[model samples]
Target: MGRTTIGKSNAKIILIGEHSVVFGQPAIALPLPSVTTTVVMSQTTHGQTLSSRYFDGPIVQMGQNLAGVAALIQALLTRFDAQDTFFHIAITSDLPAERGMGSSAAVAVAITRAMYAYFQRPLTRDLLLATVDIAEKITHGNPSGLDAATASSDVPIWFVPHQETLQIPFTLQGYLVIADSGIKGQTGRAVAAVARRKTAFAQETNAQISRLGQLSTAARQALATPDLPQLGHILNDAQQQLAGLGVSSTELNHLTQVALTAGAFGAKLTGGGMGGCLIALCPDRVTTEHVKNSLLAAGATDTWTEAFNLEEEHQ
Candidate 1:
């Protein structure tokens, strides 16, 4: 049989939701056009084994990520009755793991897509998303499923855990400067911290997360109306809530404030937060550059900006 190829899935940045999403709160997620992972499968002479290659450098393993991914693949193979199938799968991506980006989810989605194609099974977005969710559990223990959903679909989604999902309209189209801190934050550790805090202030924490979900819904309307100021306010509010969750670090807070002070419409830490990247909302390229420079000046180790065009679809 001929080699099977699948489309790549872009990495995601949780603009306004992270820890709160785990608590059944709503959050807005956007797909970045900058980084993506692809998987290609072909028959091999040897028995089943998965090989991976990163686009930038070596594939670094974190929190048993490699083993988890391998297990996911094995399960998929078993389900397809291709247990003994010999195939070679390669991956190339710019998304760095442990940087708060949806690196593992992207890998899972890409691999699942490739496997489905190889088996010549009817593929659906919903099925692929489900596979990614299971794969996520192996990495993060209890993921909110937002990462997998965003990575698999590439649409700007308003994710409310245990609630109906909404596709938010993009009103303010501009650039989003996403810069990494080069700091490694294990999702397991971050989740543990939140769990500890929950033990202390269970009701208060739950109430804050509930408010955050409501704010996220309001933010969606702001985005729909292209209200930059309102959107910025919502992001700032969400950041404060996440801070209460104990996910925001000193460095993350510093980065966010710097971006905001430098004219970024909105700024906050994305992902698990303890240490990762901060996203800055800008109205245009000029504002984005201004914020990017400010981020570097404010002790940001690495900073970059990406334009958010509504017409441009991420795959």
Candidate 2:
């Protein structure tokens, strides 16, 4: 028997900016420390095995849908010079998949970290980013690299494709209420849809994308100044732009409206947006509770709240 190794990664959510980010626009993402994915690895006489809610069997026997994870395991094995090693990799996650929560990236990060630890090798941030990116490609077809980067980071990130990622400092003076629509989001399909529309309505689409970029810039400033109202306004504008792009769905709109009616400072569909979850910004804990209850009444499948305190965060 060999030594056991464990690794963990936090989930992530895009605070603002999604499809537009692909076109070199900036976006913001926050790490969800409360939600996480963990991977445990140990030597086994048998060939590679995986145990998770979705699958339980030899890694080779996993369905094609798991090809992304399979490719990641193989890559790690080769990188560590342990191609012949047989290990049982067990995965557990609290984050829901297909909800724009960076589940796949979190899994890849956790597994990759576990493998490095198993080999007693030093794992650098650069290596971790590069390695997890390979798996992200398998899952997202063409990821913006935002998910992987944010999943591995602890603080909020400001990302511009092909440029350096910046960490944004701020104190969250309010609460974010995340409400699930209970529908799976098709990120690849959504990206392709946006591209097709861009071709059909080049000028209109490009203008909207540019507006989203502008909103992201304003959002960055609001975050720095810790202006909750200004941030909320920017979010509302971003959602309107996203809706114009045709990514917003009826369910998402309904939930967003409900949250707003319930006194949320701002509300918008997060992630790929065809279907997934929407986030509502509440000015305080009382408003957060009101919105959460209202979302439940409005048919939200699930809801969770994250509170932010800049003073505590700095400490």
Candidate 3:
């Protein structure tokens, strides 16, 4: 590489569809501008190495959890026809690992961008996502590609398996309050569990999955109409389905309940669940604060807010 290169990617949240998306259901993935992951690349005399909180050594020696990153680096080098390339990759991220905030996917996205930039190769959005998915497959056994897509996009997205993603116009008249439950989320385990649940209770499981898909469809229409309350209701309904599917954890459920009790229009766990973050829909900035405080009081490690708008809507 000629000089140091930097690549950045923001976090993302699955607005509704989760496990169901893997089964060909539509999903909404929203970008979380509050946090981000940045990867820095520079020349190194030694062989390829990675520096991050989780590991610091040769890329090949990284733990199983980081296999995706290692694989991405290998794949990138091979693509560049520089197998003997030596460089250092350093990752710094505000996106907490295992919080359903797309940490792994963001990292992979950042890495791919940096690699492409350092190689002086043009990168397209399609190429970027495809490259990142290479790593995602290693990290998440059967990822639906929502994380990579949303993490790289600036706007919200409507996602479906084996289909091109479409950006959804953003317009809502409320706020979103997100809180971390302070425990590592086992996305792999949660996804596998859902698969087992589907096998053990095919009919019921399929029904819930279909319900989540329906809710997603409704959510899209609600967003188009800019119906905040209706959107919140959809989120609440989706949460119930997720709970029935056995993915929600006690901490997540309690936090979501605390938000609802605090007057959130609706609330639910936002990702693979089992232990992660919960998102609450608040009617205004005032309610957003209340929900944020309530989640913290209910044991949330941190909180964030996203506002659709406060300006009066003709509706």
Candidate 4:
């Protein structure tokens, strides 16, 4: 029997820029350490098998939904020259799937790291990202690569597809409340809808995309000075642009409104929208609690709070 190897990755949320990032626009993504995915690997007498909440069986015969992971395992084995070896791969995650929390990317990153650890090999950041991108492609056709990049990183990231990822430095002084709407986000469908709209209204859609890109750029500057109000304003502007793109749903809008009414500095729908989570900026802990309670009262399925400080996050 071989020694067990483990790898872990945290989920992520898009603070600004979502569908627009697909068209060469910058976007910001924050790592969510509060949620995570873990992969464990161990040698086995039988062929390669997978154990997870979604499915459990030989890798070769996994369902279509798991094909990306199956291909990832195959690619890793080939990269390590261990195609003939046998192992059992087990996956566990706290991040909810289909909630626009980068669950798929987290899983891919964790599995890639575990495979490298199992082979007793060093994994570089570049290599890890490239490997994860392969899996991401299979899962999300023509992904922006933001999810994979953010999932593999700890700090907040500024990403533009096919460009070098920049780590934005900032001190967080307030609280962020994330509320899930209990509706699964249809990212593919949303992406398609945006594409159709872009084609139909080329000039208008391009203008909105350009505006979102600008907001992200400004938000990055605001983060440097740690301006919570400015950041909140940027979030609000981005949410309006997203709604114009037709990705925002009634539930998401309701949650954002509830948070804002409850004294949030700013509120917006995060991620792919159409059915996902909304994030609210609170000036302090007290406001965070108040806004959280309000969101629940307004029908939020779940709410989680994240407090950010430079000292704590950097350390």
Candidate 5:
């Protein structure tokens, strides 16, 4: 038996550039500490196993949805020369699954960090990201690695797949209202849907992708300039493109519209769309509350607020 080890990671949100990132487009994302995942690894009296709100079983018996996790555990054991060891990997997370909050990536990151700690081995940032991605590729086919990167970082970033992630300074004066639409955002299905669209309607789909990419770039500038209205417009435009790509669901659109009608400067689906949370950029605290109330009344299961400041303040 060995000492227990714990590893944890914060959730993340893509501010702009979602599906297009897979096609080499740039994206902006930031870590959200409001939600997180914690992994605990310890010597188990029983054989190798997993424990979480989602499942509890032998590692080998993990369902198809958790194949990435099982693969990560095996890979870690093999890499750290602990294949002969038997332990239980327990995951606790506040992040809502399939809400485009980087739950899978955060869990993978926590697991990798915990396993490395268990082995008393040094884990470099480069190795940590690569290790987490081994599972991300399985959970999210053709992932841009943005979620993994943001989950591990302390600041916002301008991310491009296969390129260096550039940290950005963010300190806007307002509130970012995030609301769950009471549905799972099927990222795999959304991604595959976009992929099919890209193949069948290359010109049209690529145009939408290109537009989203451009909006991400413009969004960066808007944030730098502290242009809240411009940022809101950019978000609205990006939502239109995402909807055009058929990733946005009726729930997502309705919630965003509700936020807008309730006096939000702008709002849009934040994650994989189809069925996930929407983010509303409110002009002030009062407007933020209005947006949140509207979302909840419109069937949002939950909501959180991240204030736009140099220091991340949660409400």
Candidate 6:
């Protein structure tokens, strides 16, 4: 009986520690402004219809892998079918699908939030995150549950795969420059590959992840204290761990080197990493711009800059 609309949540880039996180290492992720998804609801005469517009592909096709999302809507409709709560859902996002940037999670968060608003109910972050996790199963199969957590709450979070999940509201200093390689990474395949490899190299991988996790704790403390140099050092170590996991691509490696050579504070391949994007931690705008220029010079297809803050936004 009431219309509802939910504001979008931004996607994220792992500043450091990728595969290491899978083994229980700590990773630093910062939300990006360029990628976001919003859900809008309005009164209609028919049943619920989901419409999404993405950066690429057809708009209607955006719902291709959103089975859990569809299921959630169906369940709601069944519960209120008598009222026939006619709803029209429209999704618009800057996040690209399958890029390991938490696009699907953003959509799921927005959808759940909108649904809550429709019923004049309070929306809790936990409820929004849980709904997104269900949808993640369709897209990521066995996702690490990090992306949804990040999208649901915009901040630097510490997730220990299967061990622990916590959020640290540490305000980050300086800017983050990200460059897309125009190569899409299959997160499902990458996660599956890592799981398969775990059986053979469990001891070694677990040890590395544990080390990364310990280092991550120190890094978290450093982040809280706002020490940029120490944070950069941890990022360098985390990148090495990710490389050892065999996720870093040659192109991504080249990009990382280029950023480092250009005087970037820290640089590493982010996301699923067989291909995707690289995030460079820069100490200042000057360095960030320098790294960005170097990335473009080295054939990076797209580049974006964002300033991350741990403080919540004013509604």
TM-score of each: 0.85, 0.93, 0.89, 0.92, 0.88, 0.85
Encode model 2's per-residue lDDT on 79-101: one tens digit a residue.
77888998999999988989999
Name the candidate, 1 or 5, with the larger TM-score value: 5
Worst 10 residues of 6 by lDDT: 53-62
Write candidate 4's Cα lDDT for 43-99 as tens digits.
Answer: 988798999999998899899898789889999888889999989999999888888
Give a tens-digit lDDT track for model 6, residues 1-315: 655666577788776666667655667666666567788877777665667653233223445666666666665455445246666788888787667787877877777777777766676777677666767777667877788777866677777768766777786677777788778875556667677767789987676667767767877787788887787777777778767766777888889889989888778777878888888878776788889999999989888787655243311
* Model 3: worst 10 consecutive residues (lDDT sum): 306-315
lDDT of 5 by residue, 1-315 (tens): 568999999988888998898788989997887677999999877699899998998999999999999999999999987888989889999888878898899999999999999899999988999999889999877677778888987778798778769878875677888899999888789989999999999999999999999999999988888899999999999988999999999989899999999999888888787898889999888898989998999999999887766354577
RMSD list, candidates in order: 3.7, 2.5, 3.6, 2.3, 2.6, 3.8
lDDT of each: 0.77, 0.88, 0.88, 0.87, 0.88, 0.72
**Looking at model 2, which ten-residue stretch has the lowest summed lDDT?**
306-315
Candidate 4, clashing residue pairs?
Answer: none
lDDT of 3: 0.88
Determine the C-alpha RMSD for candidate 5 after optimal superposition of all C-alphas: 2.6
lDDT of 4: 0.87
Model 1 misses residue 58 by how many Å? 16
**Over all chains combined, what TM-score does candidate 2 have?**
0.93
Error of 6 at 140 (Å): 2.8
Query: Native-vs-model 5 lDDT?
Result: 0.88
TM-score of 3: 0.89
In terms of lDDT, the poorest run of 10 residues in model 1 is: 54-63
